[model samples]
Target: MMKIHEIRELIKLIDQSTINEFEYEENGAIVKMKKGVDAQVVSTFVPAPVAKQEIIAQPTVTSVATIEKIVEEPKAAEEVAKVEDANLHKITSPMVGTFYSSPSPDAANYVSVGDKVNDSSIVCIVEAMKLFNEIEAEVQGEIVEVLVKDGQLVEFGQPLFLVKA
Candidate 1:
């Protein structure tokens, strides 16, 4: 996990960088930051409700965007869960990166819709900062849907596949 000072430094570095968004995760802690057109600082981390609220409430920052919209936005996410079939398992991206269906441009995809997969099967890869991270289908099931296309940018926790277990 990143220390409080480290998080602050990251926020500053992201604010100054050309990139518009960044996400870092250690263990299960995640830090996400975004810069809007006005250059306001927008950041979030999961599992640390206090850290999340405190970051928004920090007095040192000139203008931190309100967390209300960010906080409320995820509430609507539950509705999607309700809409999905109860027996289906969602394969989600663990980090913010680009989704790749195959190992190489001409290689066969790791898995396709209608393909059977076990708990340890490599379903796809997500590339972040030149690192190719192989993504696994943690559920034993048939992939019923592929939610993302190759070379697409995906967000942390965004579902990439739906499987019927």
Candidate 2:
């Protein structure tokens, strides 16, 4: 079982970091925190006797304000991207990780708007657990949009690029 002080420390770290969600589990205990419009910190414990659960909604005043601001920025950006490329082929992330447009910080991006790509072409890289995996364009087309910013965390099936197939 994690102490309240430890949990408070975890929350502080999350608020200071770029991580939007965090999960920790140990000895039948699970702690999960997610930042958003209605940010929440949930902790669950399962005992051997039967099935027991508890959910605590403790959002700090400062955290709530910060979370709303963080959430709003992303929504605004996504809306613009969707409006501009409503009819394009979306290349989504295959796994959760940080999205990188170029191979290196100083290198050129693998694909840019108006660039032609085939099914085998490398479009970007998704870094997961210290490993950088090259993402391919499964559809042959000209790139019409880049949905995610470089170094942004992306989830599985999240749109990375829009291709005009």
Candidate 3:
């Protein structure tokens, strides 16, 4: 479980980064943070089974100046591409883990950019707590982009690939 100060620090880091959402989970505890319109910050917490409590924090304005600064920075080319591609389907991580593009070091990648994938196609593997979870494409499409590099730590709901359906 994360302490309140740790969560606040995470929120601050996220506010300063380009990421729009962040999630952390451990031992049945979960914390999620999302940036909303007007620079609002929303947080949700699910405690462990022993606690069995759900806590939702009210939207808070930590630093309006920082938020304004973030808004003023120009979007990069990749960011623009993501925004303009309306037909792209994002394949997101279902759990927090280390992402692997291949089954093993010597094995070929499951999928790559421009590869066609069906609903059951294995796209990647996410290893959490020593368990490798195979992630499927769920949507039939051509993969247009690979969002994360191999062995990167990914959070839940983090975009992993962009597919053109």
Give the runs in model 1 whose Cα sits over 4 Å from its true position.
1-84
- What local distance difference test score does each model get? 0.85, 0.87, 0.86
Model 2 misplaced regions, further than 4 Å: 1-86
lDDT of 2 by residue, 32-97 (tens): 998874656554333236363543444466577876776577668878977767768889998889
Per-candidate total of colliding backbone pairs: 0, 0, 0
lDDT of 3 by residue, 1-165 (tens): 788898889989999998887878999998888777577665433423545354344335768776655555534544786576877998999888999999999999999999999999999999998999999999998999999999999888888999998
Reference-based TM-score of each model: 0.53, 0.50, 0.53
Residue-by-residue lDDT tens digits, candidate 1, 1-165? 889999998888888888887888889998988787775665442432334222233344344355555555566775776677676898999999999999999999999989999999999999998999999999999999999999999888888999999
Instruction: Choose 2 or 3, whichever is better by lDDT.
Output: 2
Q: What is the C-alpha RMSD of each candidate to the true structure, in Å?
A: 19.6, 20.2, 20.2
lDDT: which candidate is best?
2
